[model samples]
Structures are given as structure tokens and as C-alpha cells.
Target: MSSVSGLVKTEQLYRSQSGWLQRAFAWCGWENGQVMANIRAGRMLTDYGRYHLSRKQFIFAAIAAALVFYMAAYLFYHSALVSIAAAGFGIIAPRFRRRSLLQQRKERLKLQFKEALFSLTSSLAAGRSLENAFLATLDDLKLLYPDPRTELLLEFQIIRFRLENAEPLEYALRNFADRAGIDEITQFTDALAACKRSGGDLLEVMKRTSAIIGEKLEIEQEIAVMIAQKRFEGRIMMAVPFVFLAFLSLAAPDYMAPLYGGIGYLLLTAALLLLLLCFWAMAKMMRIQM
Candidate 1:
């Protein structure tokens, strides 16, 4: 019995080490060939603590991409070859859609977290213990969010659970920050941990942190509003080329006939590439990283 137990422990240790090595190799870019394998296996990395797309979402995105690609190909080139080529875009579209969803979720989480900090600050100011403040903030967030499933609310519940399990407050907070994967949350947690360790006034710290986060969010909103017009213009510009091509094909098909064949196809492809590059550049310029 003792020998069997020793053998089992040795095997477990070897398997654990092997798994660690594989992950290390993946992180070091030595497993580039695994990209498609990872995606196919649904092992792709996602935003921390966020759910990946459901099967329904995947199917919907695929159908939508197919329709869009087919329509765009027919509208642009009116050739079977072009339509087939456009199908390749459908392969790439799902990843982009998934990324867009992740980004929107992150934005929502960021806003919700800011509100939660405000709630926490208020509770602390009112003489609540840190643990109680977390609990009180959950109620405040439920009022602000109204959805029990919102990211911050769920995170608060996790923190509460950990605290109830006899974990230290700072440990619970650090775990929350790790799962959040947001710089603001990480910074807040770091400050909180430091304050708790040093026996500083947490109420004052919460107040200052909440104020800073609120101000940053305000500035971000202002910047977004300021760039709204530019974003609109960029979209209009992206549409102009397609609209012009459609008009030319409709009004004077004979004149556009040359563009449908041979060297014209290459020139058109180059022009389209240039247009996409310009649109991408404009979008990057309009984006305000906060």
C-alpha cells in the first residue's frame, strides 16, 4: 500500500511538471502551430473572468458573416471568383465579433466598477467596516445595475463568499482585482492592501481613489463625445467608395466594364486595400486610450 501511494504521488508530480512546461512553451511563442488547434478546441484565451461566446452566438455570427460577405462580394465585383474570395473574410469575422463583444463587456465592467467604488466610499465614510462596506456596496450596485448578474455585483458576491470563508479582506480584494484584469481595479486593490497593512484610514483612501476614478471616467466620456463626429465622418468616408462604385455600375455599366477584368481587378484590389488602411488609420486616430 505504501509503495502504491508513493508511485501515485510520483506520477502526479511528473504530470504537473509536464503541464507547466507545455504552458510555458505556449507563452514563449514556441507553440505557434497550436493557434488553430487552440481555436478549434475552444481553448482560446478570453477576458479574465468573462464567459466566452455561446454556441448560439457562434452560429449567429457565422450566418451573419456569410450573408454580409456574399452581399458585399456580389455588390462589389459581380463575379463568382470574388464571392468565393470574400468567403475568406467570413472566416476572420467571428474573431473580430468576439473581440468586439469582449471590448463592450470590459467597458461596461469599467463603468460598473467606478459606481461600485463610489458606493464603497460612501459606506466607508458612514463608519461601515470594510467587509460591511463591501456588502452595502452590493446593495447599492444592485440598485444602480438592477441586474444581479452584472460583473461587479457577481465579483462582490465572490469577495463576500471568500471573506465568509475566513480569507483576509486584502486577499479577497486582490483575488477580485486579478479576476477583473482592469488597471483601475488593480491599482485600487494595491492601495487598499497597502493601507490595510499599514493601518491607515481606509475611508480617506477610498474617497481619494473614488474621486480619481470618477474624474478619469468623466474625461474619458468627454473625449468620446469630442471624437463622435470624427467617427461618424470616418464611417461616411468608408461608405463613399462603395456608393460611388455602385452608382458608376448602375449609371454607366459600359464605362465600368474595364474595371471588371484583368489589370483593372488588380488595380481595384489595391485601391480597396488602400481605402481599408486609411479607414483603419482614421479609427486609430479617433480612439482615446484612457
Candidate 2:
């Protein structure tokens, strides 16, 4: 019953957020165009947590996946038709790529937000109100992140823009926290709002929060460094089989020719599926939710 309700909520969200053009494209089995309508309408903020791949990027991923799948299929069964059919798996590759990209964005934003907090604390110490401090922090962030497109810089600019337009600081902060989907930012917003409401020492709170969050981020980075080596080792282990198969095919074609026949065909297919399952399982395991 819970699963059914979850599915219903998902369905409703899909209908509520998507435009007619996006819906039409999705209904026609074009996954790449699902977010194009929103993009064209300049409503990227509304889809902040979800990464939208450009059409070219989506097509490129699909093509790359198709080529890889074709090669793997050919390695197992030297049939051109089978390899072509296997390449159809590429159509779903962009979906997984989008998920991976979203994760990357989140990680970058987390680090950027940490740096922004450091800047914010410094500005708060200089006798600026929270609103003016945010505006002042932009100059510090610009020096640290010279790239105009840096995630944190863009976020600060948005906040600054909202402040200039007389929007409530809490509303702007909450919007940022919602889009970020980061616990650190959410906690900071909640704390700031509470502090402001209670007329507490906002500067001290900012200093404490920034210090704590920085230390936590440092620990996470250390742990990530340790886990990264293991992830690399696992990738090498996964690549060995493909490398071995390719070497065998090149070094002794006659030896592998039997594997393309009769019962060998069934065996190779099972092995291929098993390998894919293992890859999927490893991917899931490697994603350590922080």
C-alpha cells in the first residue's frame, strides 16, 4: 500500500511539474526533450534539484553507450545483428548520466557552500547586517571563484538579486536551501531564521555554524579520499574481464570461435547479463549517501 501511494505521488508530481510540450515529447518516447520546455521558458530555478541535459549531451551519451554496448555484444557473440540490437540499450543511458551529473553538482555545491560560509562569517564580523553581509560576501566569493558560472557564485548572485528586490532574507535562504537539498544549508537556514526571530547573536551563530560545518566537510573529504582508492580498484577489477576477452579474441580467435556456437551462445549471454548485474550492484554500493 505504501509503494502504491508512493507511485501515485510520483505520478502526480510528474503531471504537475511538466508542461504540455514536455508531456507530449515524453509520451512520444523522446526522453531528451522532457525538460526542454521548462528550459525554453527560462524556469530553470523550478527544476533546480533535477539536472537537465542539453539535447546534444543526451545524444552524445546515448551514442557513446551504444558504441560500447555494440562492442561488448560483438565480443560475446560475433553477430552484427545481435550487436545492433544490443545498442538499443543506449536509449536509457542518458537517464543514468543525468543522475550521475546531479550527484556531481550536489558535491560541488556542498564544497562551494562551505567556502561561502567562511566568507559570510568574515563579512558578519565586519559589522554588516545579514542582508548587506550576503551582498559583501559576493565580492569575496568572486575572488575565490573567478568563474562566473560557479554554482556558489550564481547562488549568491541570486540571493543578492532577491535582497535588492526587497525579498525577505528568510524566503531567499529557504529557496536556496530547497534547491540545494543539502542538510547543512537547511540547518543553517533554520538556525538563521530562529536566531533572527529571537534577536540572538547572529554573528556568533554564523561563526559557530561555519566552524562546525567546515570541520565536518574536512572529515568527509578525508573519508572520501580513502574510499576513492577502493572505488578505483573496483573499477580496475571490473575492466579486467573485458580486457582479457579482447586480448583473447585478438590473440586466439579460433579458441573463442567455439563460444559463439550452440550452447556456448547461451553461456555467453548468461555471463553478459551477470556482468551487467554485477556492474549495477557495484554502482549502487559505491554511492555512499552522506
lDDT of each: 0.77, 0.84
Candidate 2's error at 5, in angstroms?
A: 38
Off by over 4 Å in 1: 1-51, 227-229
Query: Candidate 2 — worst ten consecutive residues by lDDT sum?
Result: 25-34
**Which whole-number lDDT from 0 to 100 does residue 58 have in model 1?**
56
How many clashing pairs per prediction, in order? 0, 0
Candidate 1: tens digits of C-alpha lDDT, residues 117-234: 8888888888999999999988888888887668788788878888889999888878777777888889898988888889998888878988997888778767767788779988
- What is candidate 2's lDDT per residue for 157-268, written digit by digit as tens? 9888998899999999999999888888898999999999999999999899889988988888887787788788888888888889999999999989889799999999
RMSD of each: 9.1, 7.8
**Candidate no. 2 TM-score:** 0.86
Which regions in candidate 2 have their CA more than 4 angstroms from the true location? 1-41
